[model samples]
Target: MRRRTLHLAAVAAAALLLAGCGTQRDGTASPAPPPSPRGCPAEVRLTAADDGRALCLTTGGRLRLTLHGSEDRPWTPVTATGGALRPVNAGVAVRKGDAVAAFEAVAPGTARLTSTRPLCARRPGQNSCPGVQRWTVTVRVTAR
Candidate 1:
């Protein structure tokens, strides 16, 4: 009887250990989800510059722009309005070769950046050109 009781106690302990392993130290079942990306918004805000040359934004801020294209249709930068805002290193390609470019506010002023490339639709054996696709984003940087 004592042996049986000891065996039962060991099994109970093992079961409790397994149950606790799934829980956090604070007793929550799992960790919270990570916060959304910084400097990215669901909708782009269009603000005009005082000089009518660029859009307005805050210094030290960033703007995230995403451009979609086929695997063979990559985007290239056409123009950057001012020196206040500059593109970050290199653009990143996501699903199906879609590209994402990030621009950082470097100073307190106005700026704009334009990117262009031929838009194409790729089929199994051929590609169709719709025309040149141009994208422009302007910013007026203010002191942080």
Candidate 2:
């Protein structure tokens, strides 16, 4: 009886161990390549208005940004948006050398531009009062 109980317990423990065991994965899989930094080569530089705000636009090297306002007025919200940007001039493809950098004050009320990742946002205040945004840009290069 003692030997049988010991044998059953051993079997149960072995079964539990085997159930918990998993195939040992080998080494590591290399990390996936980074996304293209050449995403935008186009650039736009704009002058701010007396109210201290403006919007800019560019399609691959060609830049177009507009400005408006009183810099010291109560803060207003703003947003920037784009669709399939077609050139005012023809046969211009929005490619690497072609840039897309434009921001227009959609409205005059409490609106501002927020510079997030790949795109910028233009809209009125957030869930509260006025909002100000700051953006930093960096360019990088890597082997294909």
Candidate 2 residue lDDT tens string, 1-144: 999999999999999986543222442222222343554324434423212322222233433423332323222222333332322332333432122234322222222232322222333573443344333221111111
Which residue pairs in model 1 clash with each other?
55-139, 55-140, 56-140, 57-140, 81-112
Candidate 1: residue 96 lDDT (0-100): 56
Predicted candidate 1 versus true structure: per-residue lDDT over 16-131, tens digit per residue:
98654523456333322222344323223332111122235567677766655556666663356778877775455465545566677778766656666566755677868779
Full-model lDDT for every candidate: 0.56, 0.33
Worst 10 residues of 2 by lDDT: 135-144
| Backbone clashes in model 2 | 28
The predictions' CA RMSDs to the true structure, in order, are 16.3, 20.2
Q: What global local distance difference test value does model 1 have?
A: 0.56
Per-candidate clashes come to 5, 28
